[model samples]
Target: MTSDEEAFRRMVRGSEAAFAELFDRHSGAVYRYSWGLAESRDEVADIVQETFLVLWRRRKEIRLAGHSVLPWLLVCCRNTAYNHNRARRRSPAGELTEPKPGTHAWHRRVEQEQAVEELAWVREEIAALPDTERRLCDLCLIEGLSYDEAASALGISPSAARKRIQRARGKLRAAKTANL
Candidate 1:
């Protein structure tokens, strides 16, 4: 088998086969990474597709420090997923520019609205959690504190914090599933 570096070099030289080989090697991983980042199935597909598109566009500019290209691909996937999610969050439903809410479009729009409502309901539930669990969630999840930081502030071990967080997440997940 050719080295990943060699295939990448060929891809930079405009060899389509080299690109295809690289894509075949990495697309599954890219998709999984995107999905792990909380993208919907369709959005995960879009992120994977966009990651590859960015890779292809940057083939000439991408610099590989070692023999492995997988790290670069994973970074690209992470970045693409983050950007995609940020854009989605930034665009509230009311900002949608779609002209007409036709049959299929209206259905999709309603689904999106429901999803937004579901998210709001979940937030309310999180806020209603018992004191310690709620503090853990607010510190770690809402305030974006690291587990260590949140644990330290809460006077608990990191493991204990993790367990509480997991428990909290389970409650939220169960609520979501029961609704579904």
Candidate 2:
């Protein structure tokens, strides 16, 4: 079986079959994820379609988050849903009604937005790190690789990987605390 990375490479080269295979493999997950953010079934469907279309359009520019593209696709789906909701808000007909303040839905939306903001902050901090530390964080933290696995991939000792990840965590913690 071709790995998603390999399939993605083929898709980047304009292989429609590889693109279709990727869509087949990931669209269901994207749809379910969209449902969480979309206001209705029809909106979820539109978000899912838009997400994949954006992927196809930007295939040459996207980098896989690990061995797979699912993570990237999920982020794309989220952004598309956000855009869809924003457009609805601006529409003259006002298709999207704002959830009442203090309501459960409003609270949930606030929590979700906060989570997204924190994730973006962490990503920015990781990007600002030294090259080796950034790659280690990407593999061991974001990609969920075991220390030994990440160490092997980076050609470092497992203990060294552990220490670097610990240092990275400290830096991230301090940065976040400073922001707070």
Candidate 3:
């Protein structure tokens, strides 16, 4: 195998140095994917870490078919961000979710105000969900877990998780349209 491929294999074998090298190689691409999903730097950081964590956990299954690991990492980053967004929406007190801009503090407070207002609306909508449906949203959308992962987390089957998410989404859609 090529040197890069060899490195990938080493990474899969759970070498911390190998993992660090892999992280250095793919972090930029993963960050870009995360940024595309949400402008928040904090969110991007979380997604990157989560993606790498999953990769580390499933290293044996990962194959270095190409010279790059960008594609796999990007997919993981997207899913991670999706899960993060979903989880934020399920908070009980209906907290506002904003991507922490981190170093991008140049924007005016007016922009912050606008984002806060939008977040409030989102929180209210989520708060309107019934308990079961809200939990479904939490497991399915937040925490970046797959249907299986979410199901496992909630102690339900994957099929049940899928069904509950569908039903909850339908209610959310109906309620949203009612407001229009």
Candidate 4:
């Protein structure tokens, strides 16, 4: 192994100085990777911090693996960014423009009200779905399973899983069009 790889292994085993060396050697590459995805400095910084935090938490497993760290780090960054985006989407402020300091509080309140109403409508629509379709959606989409995986989990065949997902999607699209 190269000296840098050896140092990274040490760092993952909790060597503070080795961790510093690892950071110095790779933080620029990580930051650039985050910047490419997030575009916002704050979000990029969050992704970097999350990536390292996860690395530290999983250090033991990391030390056992003989693969290059860069690809693992990149995947970690991407996962972190995706998770952050999903969380931000769930926030009330996510859909609205950043409020100016001088903007009226009432205007912000109105925006929040509209967002809540939209969320309620979405919830109702989802709740209105047939139980089978709803369950399929929960397994395949929310749980992030492939059709084959979802089928195994749901005790169905892969073709059945695919058909269920397609039917569910069609139902949702029809509901959306009807609502519009």
Question: Could you tell me every candidate's TM-score relative to the true structure?
Answer: 0.51, 0.54, 0.47, 0.47
lDDT scores of the candidates, listed in order = 0.83, 0.87, 0.72, 0.74
Misplaced by over 4 Å in model 4 are 63-67, 92-180
Model 3, stretches more than 4 Å misplaced? 1-3, 39-41, 92-180
Task: Please name the candidate that would achieve the greatest lDDT relative to the true structure.
Answer: 2
Candidate 1, residues 4-103, lDDT tens digits: the string is 9998998898766568668878898887788998454658888888888888899999999788788898899888888888887887445436636667
Candidate 2 Cα errors over 4 Å, as ranges: 1-50, 53-94
Worst 10 residues of 2 by lDDT: 87-96
Q: What ranges in model 1 sit over 4 Å off?
A: 93-180
Model 2 clash pairs are none
Per-residue alpha-carbon lDDT of candidate 2 for residues 82-108, written as tens digits (9 for 90 to 100): 998888778735366989999999999
What 10-residue stretch in candidate 3 is worst by lDDT? 98-107
Task: Indicate whether candidate 1 or candidate 2 has the larger lDDT.
Answer: 2
lDDT of 3 by residue, 1-180 (tens): 235566677677655555766777778888778888854555777888889999889889887567777677877788889888777667534565655555355345558887988677765776678776666665455434578887786788889888988877787778668867
RMSD of each: 16.3, 10.9, 16.8, 15.6
How many backbone clashes can be found in candidate 3? 2
